[model samples]
Target: MVDRPLSLYCLLLPSQKMIHRLLTTAVRGLSANYRDVIYYRVKGGERLCRTPFAVFQERESGKLSPKARAAMSPEALRKQFEALSGKKRATYAAAARKNRCEIDLRRKAFKQASLSGFSHFIKTTRQWTDLGRRAKEKCCAETEKIRQAAKVERDKMVEMYYSGNAVKH
Candidate 1:
């Protein structure tokens, strides 16, 4: 027989405990997605670097995060704000004052508008409000129907498992 490492021989004839561990690890590996395998292979089994979160220390050092990069130069920042309409410009300014992050000002305006039932965002026309109300009612009805169907399916699954008649994967 050709000379080989003792560990190679041990691996070829694994113990019962080792067999169980090997099977468990194999099953876990088999369950992984094709995308995961490809990504790991391409990256040489190394994990990607994690994004650096902006802490108070970084902010105090006068370093701008990715989101605030556009507002670096005063001239560009002035031009950006000037381009916005009067109402939008005012909203952006107010959001900047309220949020220390100074990013996603439009998102803040939308959140405020949604919380107040779109009072500021929506037109003051009666017909528009009536249409919006009808749409909301329709959406609520559909949501309730879907929730009831899901509850029925969950009950069926529970009954099956408890009755020892669970479906095979």
Candidate 2:
């Protein structure tokens, strides 16, 4: 007969109750199986480290350290925001708004310019044909519209940048 531990036997034919008991003992640092326990040496004394199951349980319980909790709190966030000087905050806000507006305008222009579905095939053919002419005209009109909107947004963003203020404040 092979001299395997009882824990190995329990693993081979695991029931819910046996598995639970095994995990409980492992978490409490009392399991005879070396694989189930983690050891830590501190100040010449051996301490039991957390098993995977215990770590999983702690994560599942949503228990965070005090520092982590405080960092994520609304009051802490407000304090961080208030730490910046008003003039610097305004300058940052204006720049952010300008960048956001420019990005949105560019995205809109890209979407308008990209040919979708049958438009790709229609636009690529000879422009002298009636179908091709119509498609070309429609594409040109859309492009013109996007260019005009971008110009307007550019002017607005420039004004905001020079003034050092966003639309909201």
Candidate 3:
């Protein structure tokens, strides 16, 4: 059996403390450099970078006409719309259809112009256009064909008294 003195056991303590202090100081220096060079640059970059959508929205909002701005409350507008004659309503519908077509044409032109920059968006737009609205609607309707049956089953289950599951013992 060997009895080691406390002072002998403490021989490596100074070297370990020096190593730890050096590592901590090195890490602190490296982190400070990283914060100054990388972290600050990235934080500043986010503030400086304006996304394409943001730029588009800014320009689009600037193009809004004063007459196009709605002054009436939504309720007032709804009442006005409801009070309109069938002929006037039909006219409004036609105008809305024309406006929608114009907007679609503008959007298509914009996408074509920016196709070189946003190739991914063009691919996605092509995929979406490949599935027409009627096709998508029919697919969704087919998928939801059992919805009514499920609702009826739910109603039957909820009416536990009428459902013959009661114990007769």
Q: Report, for every candidate in turn, its global Cα lDDT versus the true structure.
A: 0.38, 0.43, 0.39
Question: Candidate 2 on 7-43: residue-level lDDT in tens?
Answer: 5444443463354344334444323322111121122
Residue-level lDDT of model 1, residues 1-169, one tens digit each, is 3243454434442463354344323443322332232222122332111112122222322556766775466565556556768776555444434333322332232233222222221213212233567665665465455456545654443344345553322
TM-score of each: 0.22, 0.27, 0.28
Question: For candidate 1, what is the lDDT?
Answer: 0.38
Please give the RMSD of candidate 2 to the true structure: 26.8
Better of 1 and 2 by TM-score: 2
Candidate 1 — which residues are off by over 4 angstroms? 1-131
C-alpha RMSD by candidate, in order: 26.4, 26.8, 29.8
Worst 10 residues of 3 by lDDT: 40-49
Model 3 misplaced regions, further than 4 Å: 1-72, 117-169
Better of 1 and 3 by lDDT: 3
lDDT of 3 by residue, 1-169 (tens): 1233444334535664354334323443333422222211222221111233332233333466656434434465466567768886665566446534533543343333322212232223323224567865654464354344444543433343234353221
Once all C-alphas are superposed, what RMSD does model 1 give against the true structure? 26.4
Please provide the root mean square deviation of candidate 3 (C-alpha atoms, Å): 29.8
Best by lDDT: 2
Clashes of each: 0, 0, 0
Estimate candidate 3's alpha-carbon lDDT, on a 0 to 1 scale.
Answer: 0.39
